[model samples]
Each structure stands twice: as C-alpha cells, then as structure tokens.
Target: MANSANALPETGFLRLPQIVGNPHANPPIPAIVPVCRSAWWLGVREGRYPKPVKLGPRTTAWRIEDIRALIASL
Candidate 1:
C-alpha cells in the first residue's frame, strides 16, 4: 500500500487508478507503481511497460502478473 502493488492478489487485472493511484479519492488509494498517468501511458507507448487489456470500449487495465513482473524488474 505504501510503495508497491504487493497488496494485489496473485492473479487478476488492475485498473489505472489501482496502479498509479488516486490520492484525492475518498480513501486515497495508494500508488502501486508511483508514476503519473501521462508518464505511465508514455511508458506503455514506448514499450517500457506492459501492454494493457481492453475490458470495455473505455476501460483499460493491466494484468496483476505483468505488474508484479514489472515491479520485480524495477
């Protein structure tokens, strides 16, 4: 909850806020990767981050496994 996505389950997908966080929300979700949204997307576009899964026309998410692997690599 502090600096990493270890709080996540062993298998699943995570939305953008659940990954980069939403500090202004009711409960103030902590960041898993600790990067701004734009930077995150840039990383994605540049192939420095994991590809996302489109769950809906407007919903994009990344696999928990991919995030875990990204954290490990970092």
Candidate 2:
C-alpha cells in the first residue's frame, strides 16, 4: 500500500514572507502583500471584501480570507 498526503486547500490568508517569515498566525496574515489602498476601498464599496477590523487606535485591516476571495472572484 502507498501512503500519500492530500493537498490542503487554502484555508487562510497570510502576510507575504518578504516582510514577515512564518510568524505565528491567528487570521493568517497573507502569503502575498496587501493590495493598494484605493483598490481595497473600491472592493469594500463593491461589496467584494468585508469591512476591515480595527487593529489599533485608528489602524484597520481587512480579513485576509476576504481579500483572497475577492481576488479569486475578480
């Protein structure tokens, strides 16, 4: 009998390794870097991506999964 490991589906998004290399992930940062600001905003306006989360006093970030889905759909 032969054993094989099934390929896992992309479950979460992550930050591009260029900036951070495999740090502990909660919401999967993103394998690729973030998209442009205007583009992201447009995506939100189009209801393609979910609203961003408040990270700091004023900073915000979109759900990585949402971003990935948006790109895929586009």
Candidate 3:
C-alpha cells in the first residue's frame, strides 16, 4: 500500500488511512503524515485541511493535489 502511494502516476484520490500512512521498523522508513481520525475531521471542520469527497455512503477521500498542497504548505 505504501508502494502504491509512491507509485501513483499523476493524479487521483487517497483514502484517510493511506494519507496517514503505515509504519515500518525496518530500513528505509516510510514518510508518515500522522493524524488521528478525529483530529483530521477537526482540521476539516476548521478549514485547515481540504474537505473530503464522499465516494459512497461510507467512503470518503481527498484529492491528491490537495494533499500535496497541504504538505507543501507545511
């Protein structure tokens, strides 16, 4: 899954878990944008982060461009 994130070709959406990232203890530690689900929702409500798009009744995601912009701003 981490590889898939790094492998994204150009543009797409990313689910919350993917955005937060996975942790590994081995060599070449992956970059993790760690944020708890509640804190993320709070950021959304406070406009500190991009609003997510509802892909279905129980699915939500944010645009890759928006996530990149947020990372750049930080």
Candidate 4:
C-alpha cells in the first residue's frame, strides 16, 4: 500500500517502520516526515510526535489520526 499521509486509512495504527518508511522496499521511499530514525524517536520523546501504544511485548504503534494531525501541523 502507498505510505503517503494522504493514503493512510482514517482510523488505524502505524508502526515505526511505516511511519519512517518501509526499508524493505527495493529503493527506499521517503517517510511522511522524512526524518532519521533517531530524530523521530527524539520527537516522540520531546512530545513533538505522538506517543506510541504498546499492542504487545514486541509491538507498538501510533494512532493514524495522531499521525494525520502531526502532518497537518507541519
């Protein structure tokens, strides 16, 4: 699926890799915010980005609406 902000579903969650960009792609695509992983984490820590929800011991994601809001703010 297309990972652009406009292509995200209205209600769901997005993992860090998806939020950053799918690294598995043949040629890496830019993330919505196009920042490095460390920067993204820093944003989360500093409250500049949405906090993630822990879905499982090895799973965490952010709400889609929260991502949309962040995009809009930018």
Tell me the TM-score of each prediction against the true structure. 0.91, 0.41, 0.72, 0.84
Residue 30 lDDT in candidate 2: 34
- Candidate 3 residue pairs that clash: none
Clashing pairs in 1: none
Question: Model 2 over residues 1-74: C-alpha lDDT tens digits?
Answer: 00101121344333233112234566543323245546656866897657666767856655555545544554
Model 2 worst lDDT window (10 residues): 1-10
Best to worst by lDDT, what's the order? 1, 4, 3, 2
lDDT of 4 by residue, 1-74 (tens): 23477798889998887788866787875577778789999999999999999999999999999999998888
lDDT, model 1: 0.89
Error of 4 at 49 (Å): 0.5
Return the number of clashes found in candidate 3.
0
Candidate 3 runs further than 4 Å off: 1-8, 22-31
State candidate 4's TM-score: 0.84
Q: Of the candidates shown, which would achieve the greatest lDDT relative to the real structure?
A: 1
Ranking by TM-score: 1, 4, 3, 2
Residue 2 lDDT (model 4): 35
Comparing 2 with 3 on TM-score, the higher-scoring candidate is 3
